[model samples]
Target: MRRQTARLYLAALSKYCGSRLGKLLGVGCGNGEFLAEASLKGFDVSGLDVSADAVQTTNTLLGREVARCSTIERAGLPDHHFDVCVCGYVIEHTREPLEFLSEVHHVLKPDGVLLLVTAASGSRPVTLENALLRTGFRSVEMMTSASRVLVLARARVRRPRPLVSVIVPVHNEHRTVARLLETLTAKELTGADKEIIVVESNSNDGSRVDVLRFAGTPGVQIVLQDRPLGKGSAVRQGLRHARGDIILIQDADLEYEIDDYDSVIEPVRTFQCAVVLGSRHSGNGKIRVFADQWLLGLVFNSGHVILTGLFNLLYRQALKDPWTMYKVFRSDCLHNLKFECNRFNFDVELLAKLIRKGHTPLEVPVNYRSRSFKEGKKIRVISDPWTWVWACLKYRVVSPYGGDCTRRTENEMGDVPDTP
Candidate 1:
């Protein structure tokens, strides 16, 4: 009967987990039958039982110290360390079943699988499934074999492919807005789900008509403003309607390449960081300058260097291009924070507030093609610099969290609100 039960557990594991070659743990492993069998089947197996004799018998049978004599709660196991855990006929005997299941959930990896076995007459399947759900398990499946019930569940802590919200603040880019929208809405662009929010700020260059062409398209949201506000206003409006887990800012013009999206979003997607900036001058040796506007380019590039240096000094950061248009971040990073910039200075304000709030952005090298003034460059060369400087100075002193400028501790900083 023990051998037959071990075979049933292994079969269930294989069916649900696909591959059985990762780290596996057996809870209440009696006599080491399941542990020994799983080890032979290519799993790096370990076991824990409350009885010292059971642990000793298992270690002796396996010719090694593979079993520990302790309950799951007191075992002091590392979190997210196991790929698969088998609890064979153990849930019925646990004094605090919810706590036992939570400990198993804690130790299992994000994509880990849990197989629980109990007596058929112990509890109803629905009751067991609800308990598993409360303990952070999903896709709960129950199977009955003779007088035993087998429950299979997956950890809910796994990171699902996130929905990316691309906010395109359009001005007078009639020449590229339509093509940009088409490319953005393409299915082959990315594997993750995307929603394109086009905020057209009442363009007179027929850009409004171009944007209207994409209206009512699936997963495409169009917001038309009464008049031209600024990139910052458009972004704030888009945020009100954004429902994605990740938020990205995209320029309507073709200056920034769309091909760099994957590299820019990879770090945030993998949970390595919450904020990322697609820099135009990081890996590239020299900033790209248009041949026709050499003098204008020189002035702009010089301004960028000075402003970047000033920003780094003010914020105690080492960023290359803080004013880059390709900013990507998780939407929840904006929780309890308010934005008030309405012009080119918005970039400075946003970056300053984010850094102040403890989300230092990760910069990734990206391709950039500068457009000349004849192609509708928007920033005012003389006045915008002063506004940016003021923004840099103001945000450093003012509070983005409703006049609460107190710096958060490392533990307190992790409490971001849910994304809308």
Candidate 2:
């Protein structure tokens, strides 16, 4: 199982590395744990550790030209020195990580790969390298999880873009579920592995009758909530069973356009980010015009903007629309995330929680359409928004990751990455 996961991690890395056997540089590579593993796989490898003792250990273990070095460039390596340079866990331990990364970029060939992995130091979005985007590169790809960091970048210059996901949260949205399914089925599903998961919560609504409707589809699945959970619970519930390479939360209602899917999935697909938010209103004059439930939709979206913006300001991270139903994420990166809300504000709470958990949401635009309260719309003018706001503020104001992971993982069966 451990070997299987390492292969998956390697296969995933090759999507960026583009080579199997090539010159490898392990920088600040103490004791050469990660590097030794790679060298054992039969690649020509070398190590440069900041600690003299660690460098001696690497030479003893791998019998490579391990050297005592403080910087990547002075490691006595040749120009365009390596095919891939891997600097794991040591980036965060440095005062000038970019200087380290710059040394890395200088040593790699034009087609060379740099796999730099770091753990999030604090529960905040921006980190060491993000503070120095212009040191030597124009575009890059970064993949992050609750505790891991992975980045892909170029040394010279080019255009940069972000990958996106379409998130749709559903509770008992069975009535119009087929509209969403058929619309996605009719799109250009051939180019990418697009997916839709219908979150069927503990619905007393006749919608569950409609949920069992799509049991035969190949890509789409209906995930039922455990216990009597809420809309957020259903969304959280479905995520456990979601198999999308990238997760897009799709509502059963077909009010949104099927054509808008491509622009949304690109950034994350290209390794730009982990979460991509689909915005209903963005980049003016480019508007989505709709008629039914016009006034209520307007009020709902207006309230949504105010709520999300307030959330961004409060959380200390730049997240847009904390309450939007359509949010997307990379499937593997979301592992081990704990959500609090059993209802709607779960989006708001999750956003703020991610901010504290050292992640951020990249907002992208999408079309918006809403139905009347009589037409199956669920947002009510009661204390619901207040409940969401309180949860958002409370979680944002506190530290959430200090909890015990073993206790948390005990109840979540598939939440942890299984090596096999």
Best by TM-score: 1
Best by lDDT: 1
Write down the TM-score for model 2. Answer: 0.59
lDDT of 1 by residue, 297-405 (tens): 8888888889889999999999999989999987656755778988888888888987876677999999888888888889888898999999999999888776632
Each model's TM-score, in the order given? 0.61, 0.59
Q: For residues 1-420, what per-residue lDDT tens digits would candidate 2 score against the true structure?
A: 133433444554566546567777777667665566666676677777767888887677667665465666566567676777777666677777667676676787765666665664462324433432434432344555656545555444222322122334555666776566666656664246655566666566766666667676765666666555666776776766665556776666666666767776776565566667777656442232336556655666667667767776777656544555666665544534566677767777666655655557788877766556676666556778898779867886654543523111222222334321
Instruction: In angstroms, give how far residue 187 of model 1 lies from its true place.
Output: 5.0
Show the lowest summed lDDT stretch of 10 residues, model 1: 411-420
Error of 2 at 211 (Å): 2.7
Question: lDDT of all the models against the reference?
Answer: 0.82, 0.60
Clash pairs, candidate 1, are: none
lDDT of 1 at 404: 39
